[model samples]
Target: MTENPYLSVFTLTKYIKRKFEADPYLRNVFVKGELSNVKIHPSGHIYFTLKDDKSRIQSAMFRSAANSLKFKPEEGMNVLITGDVNVFESSGQYQLYVQSMQPDGVGALYLAFEQLKKALAKEGLFDERWKQRLPSLPRRIGVITAQSGAAIRDICSTIQRRYPLAEICLFPAIVQGPQAAPSIVKAISSAESYGSVDVLIIGRGGGSIEDLWAFNEEIVARAIFSCRIPIISAVGHETDTTIADFVADMRAPTPTAAAELAVPSREELFERILDRKRSIYRSFSHQIKHERKRLTTTQQSYPLQFPERLYRPFTEKMANLDDRLLRNKNDITANRKHNHERLDRMLSYYSPLQRIKEESRNMDLLVERMTRSIQSDMCKNQDNFNSIIRMLRALNPLDVMERGFSIVYKEGNVVNSVNSLKVGSTVQVRLPDGTVEADIKSIKMKDKEEDSNEQ
Candidate 1:
């Protein structure tokens, strides 16, 4: 027994594959490199080459891993892939079997997920047009979550608290692990089958990206979108968002919020109904009371009883009104006549004709006084004018001549001094004449004695 000296290729491959899988170190590893020559297989697998500064390695990620990835890995994208290094015994080559991968030096898959989310948002995929509106009051709320999860319990308790009358139907689904996406899709479809449900609440408790990835799956999101009933997507914590959440009619931050959205408050609805009933009752009562008062008044009304009694008061009032009217007319006439007489008396006091007569009499007396004053003023002014004319006549040189006054002149000039003549000089002499040329006969120093003797 040479222990099957010739081993089949299949048997040898299986042996090598088993050894590689069994090795603990080879099963799990983290490889950091730049991706290259990446190609997607027809079987939903991916084959790529990871290269660094010095070396290149072949790698492959099965459909399972590729399905979970948020971004498509392209050539030249630096990545840190966590997977196993396994040798392909048939090809006599080693390749990295990728489980999960991410861009190198990046924080986590959450950041990449946010980036993709924002990019999709720009395209308006998460627009309000695509979003559905939650039902105001759902009679039956179908919750798709883990059967043992706290999300289901919280949602049920909250819904019951808000509206105890509402029926809650829980469609248990896998909220974690790889089976979560398919489970959620199936649950949504099942809820749709039950036409009694008005709304669907799909969610789970807070978890990591891997645990919450079911809500981010395209299958679950499409299922939510195609649902006829409104869906309230509550995934992870308040900050966690998924494709299903964006596409849903409403998004609740937590499972409790989802319940709150699905139902209305029983207490509030009851209170509103009670208030409306009271209002209707009060309104009816007020209308009845008003009608009764109208009926009672009609029975007591004079027009409703004896028709002639209605006119009796009017007949008496008419007579009294006529008498009062006549009295008012007489009073008005008397007042008008009195006012006319008073007006005439007042007019006589300040009449223009009387004022003119009085003024004329006053003017006659004023004219007599003025005439005397003018005579007195004329006598004074004439005396003054005569005295002024007499004084002027006394100062006139021609008046002096009229009084036989004579003047002496030499050389056409009046001369009152003997010095005016020069000794042995020609001079003109005249007595009150226009002009005179004279010759001085002598010069005299005894002018004072001569002037005194002449005076």
Candidate 2:
């Protein structure tokens, strides 16, 4: 057998590079680490080393790619990079060229929430002044959350146990998934349409940050911020904080806590009812005592019946009353007769029928004047109409054409002045009979001798 030739080190390295490129698994890989050494080239290339406690790897991102980054990549910052592994053709070394990057710890979603919170805070959405105060005892309350979620059940049970009199209207929606954001916004808007709802509880069962992302979505946040009714944001565990909680009128760590915030305690309300009953009873008892005293005084001062005891005095008073009554009647009859006579004199002096006749005469005179003015205006309008008709007839183009005059048109346009009639220009002459196309043979703009003779 012939002796085999060994390959050089460069050739061996090139073979290894080919093998790395051929591996499908190297096409896409995700890395998590803290940035250690970072250098930016003048040409917009970013070179960095990502290291954790034990190991490290080199990473590079071109300026074109770095420009799309939302947050600056700095040293000591942990990050997650999605990119591919490839050999540098010049150096014969494998490295990661990142396509996109984000903060590593807490994942991209949590970082995004923080960024959005900062931005919305600048716009006053998270300001405490913009939030409304919740009523202590609302007549009706709206609860917008997942219908099947334990949060809803917990809130319902707690509300029933605490304050059963409060009316709770449930606006159900998806509390998770891509559809959750829009569904939450819709539920909030629909709750507003109920018009009489005093407070709204928007929340769901406690879970991971990912599970509660719907409450942090911008649409849901904005809807909560703009709600006319007060909102109680109850989401996740006690330590969990979301955008909804920050913008809501009140924040509750759990759904049961939110229910407690929305309504009053039944035992406390019953105590208050009892106090009111006692006050009313005292007020009625005082009134009854006052009336009973007044009745006793009246019964002791007055007589029930005195038939013969009052008869003698009454008879003497009757005789005097009869004489006075007769005198008063006579005086009344005379005064009535005198008043009747005065009324008759007043009727004769100022006769309503004669006044009506005089008013009728004045009305006829006014009618006659109005009729004359209207007739005069009509005659003037008729004369103006006839004059307008005569003027229009004189200016009519057809009438001029019938009188043996013609109009010249060039290129479908009427030539109104002699300046438009250029020598050797073609034009159409319109007459009563028909139109005739002709060429200008001579130019006669104006004759000075004819003008002098006319002057």
Candidate 3:
């Protein structure tokens, strides 16, 4: 059998890629779809998906084509894309190589506005913490917009009507088109160079997003954020907002509003000053009245109106105290004289002769008491001795011998039992009258005759 020739997988892929290149329709195709998974790489290449409700295709825009885009692409945004459909040789995948793309339904300017707004917002450029405070009353108002436009005219007239004393310095700028952003920035820097303005009114009259896009430029947003002078953004109508509005210190709906915000009304300020002056005068008057009333009361006080009467009571009180002191002194002297006489009599009664007689009598009484105590103690001891003598006689051993019991002794030691004596031992017997000496003979036991320990 013969083997049939077959192509390799890579060869088939290369063939499909070549077919895509050769087909004129696929080489230059137009696709209308909603953008999805849109991503712009650091290398300036854009990767995204072009999808309709029913289907989607992988799409890519190289850096060259992407640089020409005036508006940023976003996911879920409807767009019309011009590109070539081809097979990615490496992966064998069919995809779109996009060259040009523009928003399909919405204006490209609006898309760019939203895209930059989102990016700056994420960067915290729109944070309220970064917003500066508007000056209460600016000395010179710096206006950054076209010189001949209605925006500048409105701002100047409004300031003149509300606060006529303010100085308006116009930094004439191109307020529309590609050159508007840089012109506005240069004007801002110029205003800063002069350094006379207290606050800046950077805005234009109401216009479309494209017409007002100068303020939406990134340079303008950065300039507003970095401005030393406070900025009041007045761009477009009340319903319109831009990147400049978010980055500015304050946002006014109109150029007139922005001018009003930069300066205070002379009428209101005058009224406020008058109110404060009236308050201060009222306080001063009240204080003066209070002090005057206090002075009147002091003048009518008792000490000031009746000085003689005030001292009369003190004089009478001093005279009464003098009389009482004289009486007290006379009584004190009489009492002292009586006490001295009593003390003299007491000294005479306690003379030395009388004291000696009393002491000698006390000594004689003490000696008699001592003699009686010694006699009573001797009698008590004598009676105790007689009673002890009777007890000793009752307990005498000779008394027991008189009852026919005798105490035996062996070699001068007392023997109370016959078993205590051995044969041929000399013993002494103790009787009531005298002691008799004897010798111990042979011992014999009488059977059943006598047991001294038997019951």
Candidate 4:
């Protein structure tokens, strides 16, 4: 069997890539398609798919080429693209390496502007709630535009003419082409860095939407939206609209109008001040007349004309109240006397003297009972004590000794038994009056009858 394969998958893809690159028509092809799945890289490269109704092709725009684009590329935009068509080696598919792109029919800038407007609006960037109010009288006006452009001149001149005290500081920027958006953003940042601008005028002279596209850029719109200084957007003619107009603090018809919005006209202000003075005078006159009428009416009124008459009702009412109070006081005194008499009678009826007498009798009785009890307790205790003392005296050997009985001791111990006395032992004899020390002569055991009787 012969081998069926002739080439690897990479070899076929390489061949196709070489064929695509070598073709003269594919080298620089112009195609028109609607953009889809567009993605912008942080490195400024662009990746997107170009699609018509029936077919699509992958496309890439490098940073170098994309950086030159006058408009931001967005999805679903019908655009004319110029690029090289070649097979991407990794994907093995032919795609466009985009060099440049332009809107097919509608202006690219207008499409970009509308697309950005919709996107930013969806993100709540264009909400009226986020817009700041322009200062009524701005002290410092920051102008962000080309210093050479008519916008700065118109703004400065208008501000000077309308309100000469307004200090104008210029932040020079590129107002057209690809560099315009970043330049304007940097200018705004620079303006903010200088730190004294009360209001900012961002604009360019009348031009095409493409010429004013920098104002439409997302960066510029965000910069305008984020500015701490109130911003007035003036781009192109009155009819021209951009994203900057939507996000700025105020949108003016033209550069001159922006300056007018930012600063008040001195002449008009002076006229307003005059009108205010006239109004103040009229108000003062009216107030003075009204107050004078009030004062006159007050003076003519009965209370102010006759001071004693004003107090007549109060005096009469006070007299009536005093009369009623006197009557009430007398009645209250009578009633209080009656109540006091009734209370005294009740108190007498329930007086504690009887209770005290009864208590005293009961206390006396209790004292008598207690005295009898004490006397009986003392007599009984005395009898018991006397009986115990008699018993003790009867049992006492000292009493026996006083009755002429003696106590015999052998070596300071009692000799209760005859066996306790040893012959020839010295002994002590204790009588009631004195003690005798004697020598033991004999000791004999007593009879059993006598010992038993003694025990």
Best model per lDDT: 3
Candidate 2 has an lDDT of 0.89
Candidate 2: stretches off by over 4 Å: 1-26, 29-77, 85-102, 275-455
- Model 4 — which ten-residue stretch has the worst lDDT? 106-115
Which pairs in model 1 have colliding backbones?
Answer: 132-249, 412-436, 426-438, 426-439, 427-437, 427-438, 427-439, 428-436, 428-437, 428-438
- Stretches of candidate 4 off by over 4 Å are 1-13, 34-77, 90-92, 302-395, 402-455
lDDT, candidate 3, 24-49, per-residue tens: 99988988999889899999999999
Query: What does the lDDT come to for candidate 3?
Result: 0.89
TM values, all candidates: 0.49, 0.47, 0.59, 0.66
In order of listing, the candidates' clash counts read: 10, 1, 0, 0
- The TM-score that candidate 4 achieves is 0.66
Task: Give lDDT per model, in order.
Answer: 0.84, 0.89, 0.89, 0.88
- Highest TM-score: give the candidate number: 4
Task: Predict model 1's lDDT versus the native.
Answer: 0.84
* Residue-level error in angstroms, candidate 3, position 435: 99
> Candidate 3: which stretches are off by over 4 Å?
1-24, 34-37, 51-56, 74-78, 86-94, 103-106, 306-455
Pick by TM-score: 1 or 2, better one:
1
On TM-score, the stronger of 1 and 3 is: 3
Per-residue lDDT of candidate 1, residues 28-74 (tens digit): 89889999999988998999999999999999999988987777777
- Which regions of candidate 1 are displaced past 4 Å? 1-33, 36-38, 45-71, 81-100, 115-125, 274-455
Which residue pairs of candidate 4 clash?
Answer: none
